[model samples]
Target: MAAPRSVEPADLSPLAWRLLRVAADYEQRTVEREIDDILQAHISMLENGSRALSPSRCNTLFALYSAELTEEQIRAIAENF
Candidate 1:
């Protein structure tokens, strides 16, 4: 499965971008949440770098974007978070 890539925000880590993209997709498709607004909030939280994906949320995100990333990749990314 090919992953989504962003050219901008060169400072943003690959994992950060993928995690946020998956979160946004979940928010829009599964939860019926207000995606654009909530996505902004998620982005803000991640940009600070002090915050990391909690265990539960990380699992949920892995399930949602499973095609784009693997459990190993998720764990590797979470280690840096």
Candidate 2:
């Protein structure tokens, strides 16, 4: 196996660029929600121990953000959880 090389945004197809942006945005939103949830007592930091979102929740958030992404992309993003 080899290390992946970094590429400029100009190197990506329009769709790929869009997907990348969406994924990054999703991550930011999820992290923000987790922080808010912890402060509001909606989730317990001591018990849960981790701030990661579940796969189903990721799917829901992705859906809320965009309908353009394929199912494979959605699943791939959710699997990060």
User: Best candidate, TM-score-wise?
Assistant: 1
On the 0 to 100 scale, the lDDT of residue 80 in model 1 is: 55
Per residue, candidate 2 scores C-alpha lDDT tens digits across 1-81 of 111223322233334433543554644445446443323221232114344345454334334443444455544443433
Error of 2 at 69 (Å): 0.7
> Model 2, residue 21: what's the lDDT?
34
Question: 41 in model 2: Cα distance from truth in Å?
Answer: 17
Question: Model 1: how far is 31 from its true place, Å?
Answer: 7.9
State which candidate has the highest lDDT.
Answer: 1
The local distance difference test score of model 1 is 0.45
**Candidates' C-alpha lDDT:** 0.45, 0.37
* TM-score on alpha carbons, each prediction: 0.34, 0.25
The list of candidate 2 runs beyond 4 A from truth reads 1-21, 24-61
